[model samples]
Target chain A: MNIFASLSRKPWIWSFVAAFVVWIATILFTGGTSAIGLSQAALTFAAFSILVGIGQMFVITLGPGNIDLCVPATMTLAGTIALKFMQVDNSLILPGLVVAVAIGAVVGMGNFALIKLLQIPPIIATLSMSFIVQSTAIWTNRGLRIKPPQALAKFTTETTIGIPHVALVALVLSVFAFILLQKTVYGRWIAAIGQSNRAARMAGIPVDGTRFVTYILCAVLAAFCGYLLASFSGGAALNMGSEYLLMSIAVVVIGGTAVAGGNSNVAGIWGASLFMFLVVSMLNTYGAGAGIRLIMTGLIIIAVIVAAGGRNPNQR
Target chain B: MKRALPSDSIRLLIPALSLTILLIAVFYLQPRAMSYVGLNLLFNLAVPIALATIAQMLIMTVNDLDLSMGTFVSFVACVAATFLQATPVIGVLILVAAIATYAALGVLIHVRTLPSIVVTLGMSFVWGGLAVLILPAPGGHAPEWARAVMISRPPLVPMAIIACVVIAMVAHFVIMRSSIGVILRGVGGNARSVERAGWSILGARAATYALAAFFAILAGISLVGLTTSADANIALRYTLLSIAGVILGGGEFTGGRVSPIGAVIGALTLTLAGSFLSFLRISPDWQIGAQGAILIVVLGLRLLLNRLENREKRS
Candidate 1:
């Protein structure tokens, strides 16, 4: 009964337990110091996914089949734009971040417009937008390599109390996200909209407005993640942002947020992101090739999704 | 008022109109494109895309999205390049097993009441992994017979154009003009109703998924044939392109309303657009963006037309 109660209260328990087991195994095989290094690396990278998962959590909570598929493209475009604008000067960092944010907001608006004005499905609408964004990124850059500024790179990579600075930022963001979702009226409105749009509209919950805002916010988060990743890597590549697209969705769903909406798991997202990262790290520790890792990740995603689908909110 | 074109005709009209516009643009940009040789070159890569689009259309007809179509095709290509070249019987068995897996996927989706998007998205990774494991890199030869068939040319027309016509006609007849087609579409339109009408919903879904797999298999084999090589990453773009093609061809996400004819034409339009941009000497980087822009503009126009039609009806 105690176990059941805990599981009910914390949907993220499954992921945490899974991650812990994997971490132990990794430590057993790779020694204590290397395990710590893997943990630090995973935690640092998990920050990017946590940011993406938050925005995706909001959108997925918007109702069944409501997803933003343009995240990777948006991130790639943002990174490209940031690299082009940041230059070599340290003073340009703030302006570059602002530019990335603004571009994300605009792209989000475009996604909203496509979904609302044209009544195109969310998946297709975002996908088409992503393609357009990809094109713009590619055409403008042609695979140009511009190193990130010193300040931004330091901000992303530097450690504080053995935790990467970005991880600390992500921690604060997750807390804020948790409070927003669990305590705010706006969060309630989003939850209502997700459960049933028609009912929410009948109850005067401003369904479309909330959904529009959610999509924009998700894009903004993705854009920020792209910027951070570009800085962390010291440069951007054409396909730099591709992996985040699926990773974000996988984190959200595996974090126990119902894919059919009506539920938001802010805390769960943090744990799930860490779990996914650890899975990758563990595979790497075992010297598993990319193909084996790919297969394992795919199988894990399917298994988790299948398990969650059993009690999905959308099912009658 | 007496004769506004029927809605079905209007549905078919859009793709025709867009294809013509694209052809004219291509010809105007490069007069040499009007020749058979030029067209052969322009549309040489379109066959695989058209076949993949048709595969997507089949899945759409059953109200399921196969997000793995692109990677699954690549997996098939890998098998074609390796096993088909070295061991013909093994290659045939592997391809058949892959199709069976697709059929099993449909059953699993139905039984588990799982979202097709998530399931297929996960499967895309699996297929990609398999592809990587099989090829490990970007070098493999297609079977000799497959290469011969792909390279074959006849008088007065490009092989690609002729093949497109034949494939479209065959798909249309099977999926739109036959009894089983009606049943399949019925399953998509209303599964409960189809079940009530004594049709097996699960069976229809399995059949559609199997047919989709079959088409994707063809797409992969032909892709290998054309390129005479296979890579784990080849055909990755087909996932989005096929979905876009289906929608541009007037297919919807909900209902079983898809058009093989329109899908083939949509693929042709997109292929031509890409070739046309290349002919204009635009950077390869911009080619994808240009293709996307065309999809948006065409879909936007279709939406505008829909509004007008609705307004006219009300008046």
Candidate 2:
């Protein structure tokens, strides 16, 4: 009873409910005759949402009024590097994944260094980084598409017992992330750092190193998700990762994670992801094109954020 | 007679240096492209972006950023096109109406004290949708007379360049002299302080938004004439470019100082950069990459400079 009451009081709960209602309405009105394909699509969207949401959650965990703007570029660069490597040699799939993760780590480290060294605000630094990443990706691709290898594609496509393979990957990643964030000493430190960074440093926590690692981990997760997305679609495009930017932020907000940091709810994110997928599906069924879909998504996010209020009234 | 550097004078130099470097590079590379006609093209191109950059700077001054300025420009342009394709007079009216509508929307958003990032983003989508609904495929031209007046070259100098100079001068005067201008700078520097001083922060923010929307409309008008047609993607580039210009011009995210002349110089620099890239016959992909790279470098430099300045102050 206490758990239920506590969950109910969460600001994200209302958004989750709203998203669920919209999703159910979409499924019912659309008539789920093509259940297999729809289910596959829903699963894939849900999985990617979790991956991106986790990245957002990590940044929020640092608190100190921080947000990352380089998420889309980070995801794109990860996927692009993975695809480029896979193209060069068919056997380099695992190695390519490692390279992508390394790239994400470097990006994370660079972001942390810039923020700490120059006193550039986190948002501005991340934003500038995003531009650099996007520009670099465009230059590398040379207006051409890079397709993933057959085996990687199969991994994303092949279903186990009717569920999509990508969906399974998302589930595994989420569970791992949930455990790491909840049961680990690192998780406790994240909570502490978010609540009060100065105090955490005084308490002997490696605040800078911890922040650096969390951002890198976030980027790595996003990269992994990007690889899945690229593999699923068979290739990557210039603007392929742009859609995920807002979606990631929306999921985190909807999942009962305070934007100000120090607190998070994985279950809430999971629920929100599910609801968001349904809403998108419904909007698609109603004959809404990409432009309208984007508009509706933006409006919905704003509405949710407004309901949650800005940056928690109590936090300084 | 030696005089101390006015606070605004140093602010103006940043853009001047950027513009000078860009122009020198262009002229050095392709003197042929520096014709009167080319100069006109540069000025025309800079107008919309300059207006939009000023708009972005205005909101940013209050510690808010509008990611939707581009979409608003597209919306106004498309709506005006729908009405003006047949009658240019009606098109001007439609443009005015669209601007007024967006301004009202901006006021409402400010009243709610909602995060401008999300609100403007959502508004961008709404405006983009409306634009697409009005012109699904981006056809329908502006009147020849409208285009002629906009694109015309004067005997001594390009009319477009003259118009830009005039606008910059007027904006500089108003920014330095107006009561609202002073309040805007105060609010940008510290909104909480102003609110505590018993000023209506909401009203000030709304007025700033109104000013931004007004400039967005002017940008739209210039853009519609330049392309001679309306398209959904027209506004997308301006959003990022405007931010780049504002930051390049030394406009802080927190409001206190404004440099309209600085923004113009930033706009000119951007225009020259684009022209220089084109003269080199670089692929469109490389041009975009270059733009992004330049912005990042500038921002990094700005941060480094600020840090050095802070250290100097402490010492």
Per-residue accuracy of model 1 over A1-316 as CA lDDT, tens digit each: 9978767556676667667777888888876868668878888989999998898899999887688888988888898789789886799998999989988999999999988887777887888888788888887667788888988888899898889988998889889888888899889988888888888999988787888888899999888888888899998788988888878888887787876788788877877888888888888889989888888878877887776667544442
- Candidate 1 is graded, for docking, as medium
Residue pairs in collision within model 2 = B61-B255, B188-B255, B189-B255
Best candidate (score: TM-score): 1
What does DockQ give for each predicted structure? 0.57, 0.33
CAPRI grade, predicted model 2: acceptable
How high is the lDDT of residue A104 in model 2? 82
Error of 2 at A262 (Å): 5.4
Put down candidate 2 lDDT per residue, A51-154, tens digits, no spaces: 88888788877884466777888878888878998894669889988878887887787677766765566765676677677777777766567888888888
Q: What's the TM for chain B in candidate 2?
A: 0.88
* Two-chain complex of model 1, DockQ on C-alpha atoms against the true structure: 0.57
* Model 2, position A225: C-alpha lDDT score: 78
